[model samples]
Target chain A: MSQYSEDSGYVVAVDVGGTSMKGGVVTRSGEVVATDRRPTGAEGGPENVVAAIRSFVGDLAARGSSLLGRAPAAVGIAVPGLVDDATATALYAANLGWRDVPATGLVPLDVPVLLGHDVRTGGLAESVLGAGRELTDFLFLPIGTGIAGAMIIKGGPYGGTSGWAGEIGHIPVFPEGERCACGQTGCLETYASAAAVARRYSARAASPATAERVAALTAAGDPVAVKVWDDAVEALSLALATYTLLLDPSAIVLGGGLAEAGPLLSDPLAARLGERLTFRSAPPLRKAALGVSAGMLGAALLGWRAAGVPDARASWALDVPKTSAVP
Target chain B: MSQYSEDSGYVVAVDVGGTSMKGGVVTRSGEVVATDRRPTGAEGGPENVVAAIRSFVGDLAARGSSLLGRAPAAVGIAVPGLVDDATATALYAANLGWRDVPATGLVPLDVPVLLGHDVRTGGLAESVLGAGRELTDFLFLPIGTGIAGAMIIKGGPYGGTSGWAGEIGHIPVFPEGERCACGQTGCLETYASAAAVARRYSARAASPATAERVAALTAAGDPVAVKVWDDAVEALSLALATYTLLLDPSAIVLGGGLAEAGPLLSDPLAARLGERLTFRSAPPLRKAALGVSAGMLGAALLGWRAAGVPDARASWALDVPKTSAVP
Candidate 1:
């Protein structure tokens, strides 16, 4: 917990989501000395959310300073939607209702700041410290309220062309299946997202239930729940198979709420994904190690990078090893 | 016809396909000083094909030696297989019936040699000299007897974790549709390959017709031909949409015999692709500029790369001039 100058050695790491944001004060040696969460005030619109985030960063830095006696060396942030990492700006996030919000606007501190796309930042954490530790190329797929993937190519997250890459949620997995909220037809997210799974099951079942309840009900052989779960699995199988063929990922790291169902989801999903690939074997699916904290940890890595300590995570060797222990 | 030296400026280039192989002697300045073609001898077995390639390469080098007053400086071969470029070995090609064939086995000359996968090598050519010029990321789709793609990422072709990255044609576009020869159901290849287009049209129409003839008939308003063509276009739209959503490529370059239909193919594909992508504009569909010569030219680039001249193609302006090109 004590490395460098203790307080001054840590960085303020934040993961900003549409509904809420998670913040932490993390040391260079991969220790989270202080952590907190707060509502993003998104209901009050983009400016309110920005003010909340800036206040949160200030509070975290002040807490760290009190704990160890100095200001944080740098700040790292993860935000939803399009990000221009080169300029450290949040280009656009439809859900956040913001465009071109510079990283400077999100932090009250005067230290070096860096930004990353929310999903890709989580992918970076998974790549550096979690399920994908051994992989140079893989897909980090987080399935929760919505689905998106971070394509880890040549050991880093790849945001193609205009930073719009990894919109896997919007891809049409079942071409004639259903309409998505984004106005696309037969999207994978329409059936496979945790929110979608619960929504779909509730629309057909006798009672409304969470995705967790749906998983348990399906496992207990409830026919309606089973049908809904099977559709999600089928949709995922198609999308995963397509990803495998196109990217040939070493493995797929699954995280977020849907994955907490554990083997109940992985077992059938794995079998179906294998069956779909005719010429090549299916890439193994591994559970994410960092879970919901991946983005925050990844921001810590970005913070470390900003502080000119690239090997800090490497030296710590926390959580998982190069030969990942996620299983 | 020459740049480095009049006596030794050229390299031997070969594009080895399942049925035939194209060979060329290309100078550093990007001129094909001589060219030839021959059977791959695949039916006679892998050894026969290897021996045939060696003889063909020797003959091309001899021709270049007489023309340039010296032996070629390097060799580049594009094979239809999984290639370990780092080791210069062709690992496997089901069609070519080869395994563990070293690049040296096909090149009698002692100069440096490099091997690349057929599709990716062609994509490299497209990236450096053809339709994908000036673009850092794009998909080069060639709809021939079969379908495959070259995913040009970061100004070069990207082969995935195990050199199988761009198998775009095998993606399941229609989940419950026709089974493919690869034993996968609803593959883009099953519905959209030139052979598939010709075969489907022939099966439904009174008379048999080639894919080129089918394209002509579709243009002339033949219902059967139009149906087959439409299915191909629809399959293509779905695959491209999926690709765009996943990779966000700048453009998609269409090549091969079917692409010669020009507006007959691109017009409907562009419209349908745009319709499929609700949030993002569809990437423009461009015609592949180099045609059948793409693979051979890519092999030349590989040859120059093997000879330690990475910028040989950049030295010559083929399409849109690179900003670094000399005045």
Candidate 2:
């Protein structure tokens, strides 16, 4: 263990998803230890979801301490929707059916708490430890079950004055097309999200195949799947192109489940973005590196930072204790 | 005169435009007391334009000393295009026909010089003293012969990392629409600029008339006039709606010649924007109060701040020595 290690010191990180609650202990160097997952129990109300999170955190802490000999010193949690970082409040989360959730107070641990929006926290991870680490200005856009993004300006995440700055998914892409779950018509998420891709392919193909099968068909030159895939790429390109003109980022990092397609996504997106931009430099398109662990790593970083750990080195040092209390 | 105003002293403020150069002495209280104008003479080349500005400043200083009763302490210049405010460098301005214009040495002023983009400086004036003074996070969009905007974030203008933050007019509105002078297709300016309104009305009207005449006829419910007017409103609304989702600004201040249409522009724009935004709050739309002098006022404010003029007092008191020498 390094000089900064404390026997009772740990950093807890949680990612609150629409369907599940995933969390773990993270050492200062961006490593996840003793991670655990459970259904969000969202339909059981916010209290039940909190109870699940508490249980998850308790189990992770027990396992992490037994393995590494430490108790957490601080905690960080991320959720979807409008967040009030200044107040540590979850102002709203449409998917989780939460409003003004005082996340900082909900954690039973007597430690410093940090709260952030999920996509932004994911972006924080990318900006600090992923593909965007070298770029001062970049947009971290994750196209997954639903589409969302975070803007990094001058190496810092920019939450608009209202904390809704990176809601690019809500922007109308098709003008008057299909209605979105958000009650809007033709939002980018309705067309470009992973779920949207599957739904669109299923509707068009009428063969009722899984998204993976659709991707396979698209690769094999199936016309219906090709058309659906092309439309998704086109929509994503337009959205990204619009963002390039507006923000002029140095690069764009594509993450989330759908990004697993790798070059299948990056190649077409780069071409479309390049074609749209004339006078401005077309930012490079890259895939996110941290993968599914990005959110927890980011949340842990947030926790360490909130506890006044200045840099990644300090966090890493705090991860492993020099001595074990049980021994 | 104010305390800082001394006879033979002067402050230079330059307004760099697409086709011409306008500049003058700006009083400490945001007033332009003496002014000069000349063709930017870009046809002679970028070097010639710089030489013209140098001569213009020298001539203005030589002639306006008696009128001003003091030498200027600082200079503030507003230019068109991307400007890196941190380094005081004009990164790129297509209209000015210059790239990376080093403003510090270009102006050739002895006093402290403050440089800012023309539209952003105008936005500063609007935010401090014009239509948007009461609101935070407002957009100042000026639609004249061309279109551009300045975003006021958290009560200060956001000069994007490269100083190209507020290019709202360049965002693509129609993917397959007309080509823009900027070599892009379907830019908002191609459809909504004052020049665009005149051109569209001329091409589509049965008996073509001046934009003023078209405006009058549109007021009287002529079908062609109404169509042209509605199309412009549609483009502007779409652009503003996209901006609303991105920035969530509190209000939008409309300036420049097109704003003179008053209710003809605002009423339809409000209705269209409202129809488009379902989840987000629709920012209030209003006309700019500074009108033709917004840039000048902004320039003056920049001069005042650069000269170390405090804002607590409304006016400055200057002592001028008696002098009889005349040029």
Candidate 3:
């Protein structure tokens, strides 16, 4: 609902995933002025992916200037990997097959450039604009392909010393029970992540089905689906209970694909987490409202922050976008 | 060696433990001008303990006034419990058998008073004067009769909402492996706490021996002691590794009674934690340098802050106290 006028400046924001690159031109008030996308070309090699990102940013910049009558004041990029936000460098990304790439330096723009991890960026967006609004302390957990967390402490995203603070997925929930791709045992992601649920269900059911289908099947009283779904809920709740004992957040916002299951996910998770916690009470578990566009919006907010705009005016406090992508 | 002149000012600081109450009259530079101790009288129940604390603080205030040639500027009390640091209220202390006691109100003093949890206060002291000095991000784990942690973030103590942020002791390490007194299963404290080590050793050896004696026995090649010590180290390392994956602390400072085991505790712990970590490197494990007086010193620091004094003048950067009690 935010409108951009002639005087309103713009920021270019991009969110790079394993398969696609999402880019947007956003006004100061967080309105999407223009948008674009491109295939990551990841399978082609790291150089191809890097080149694609450069072309995407260039296109967005040109489109932004034409739409806003001026070039963007700043650019913000979010990538899925071990990103060092302080230096705007992608330290390492296994899926992207890149390391030590200075992402901010790759963009040949006149404005300031900022870079951050994809999950943290999405959490920041949700915290400021979606379900987490008005809460200063909470955890934004995105149960996507692999589980990750964005810790919102004192009203802002908290990246640990090595920019790897919210690796909640890697926390051993089963204690040497199952091996993880990260060379760890019993990681929460190994059992509870959306990809894990689908893969495990498919292996047992002898047919490939998305996590969404598994949830539907469980609701319809499918025995195998029920077992798999119950296990995921139990693992998630246990990990959350442990986190509650450590940080004691005010609430936990469940985002990403798995959370889209709505009551099916929240209901069982609440009951299990409540049972696990004895002394300390379990925090409210709310679903994220921003959907998939959260990463792009969060990147835009960071762009405004890089342009020295205050957080209050920089964030999107408007209603959630109805479309799957940024409006 | 900070010399207390008549005009320099002083504060009364108390650290109330399960067995004894340690009180001190501290100068501006963390020097203990006078000190006293009293039995907690816990067997007489909560009211008796409260009365003892009142008498101890009143006596310390009188002694401090006489020693400094003026009344103390502030008072700081550190107790083992669920404390509401903002309101100076002791919410609950299982050891002290008190709940919802307004400790500051009981002081009946004109000076500002501050109350905090014992572990967090020790962490604050370590952050300013000991191993954690100059580090903004770290975890302070004290393996005493019960395990607790003080999380130092952004160069200051972090007391979570309701002042229960660092209850790492209660985190289910074994997940239904052992029964803890708190009615939990396989808690980190159940296996790794100093009291647990001593009690387990005493139970199995059929002769009473403290955790210190068990360490000595392990060094002398006692099979039982070696097994018990190895299990303790494994449990502690597992819990610490999980914490590292979550918080990514720069270092972990081990304090309290068990840390007195020195290399026998740290060396094995460091190696085990390093082996457990895959993507992220293990943080350095360091023994607490402030000894048992960390609580008293930290309380004094809080007293100075409460009295509106600058930190440079309030810190004990001069010398390490050699005496068992505060010097």
Best by DockQ: 1
Give model 3's TM-score for chain A to 2 decimal places.
Answer: 0.95
Q: Per-residue lDDT for A1-327 in model 2, tens only?
A: 533345435688888889887787776654555577778898998777767777776676676667667677678887888889888888887777778878655577667888888888988877776778777788898888888788887677878768777778878766657898888777888888888888988887776876667677888999998888888887788778777777677788998877887787788878887888787777888888777766776787788877778486333432222211111
Which parts of model 1 have CA positions greater than 4 angstroms off?
Answer: A1-8, A320-327, B1-8, B319-327
Clashes of 2: 17
| Model 3 residue B327 CA deviation in Å | 8.4
Q: What TM-score is obtained for chain B in each of the predicted models? A: 0.95, 0.87, 0.94
lDDT of model 3, residue B53: 84
lDDT of 3 at B191: 84
Chain A vs native chain A, TM-score per candidate: 0.95, 0.90, 0.95
Please report how far candidate 1 places residue B204 from its true position, in Å: 0.6
Q: Which stretches in model 3 have alpha-carbon errors above 4 Å?
A: A1-3, A312-315, A320-324, B1-3, B205-207, B313-315, B321-324
Which candidate leads the pack in lDDT? 1
DockQ of each: 0.87, 0.51, 0.71
For each model in turn, which proportion of the native inter-chain contacts is also found? 0.89, 0.45, 0.57
Reference contacts reproduced by model 2: 0.45
lDDT of 1 by residue, B192-228 (tens): 9999998899889967889999999999998989999
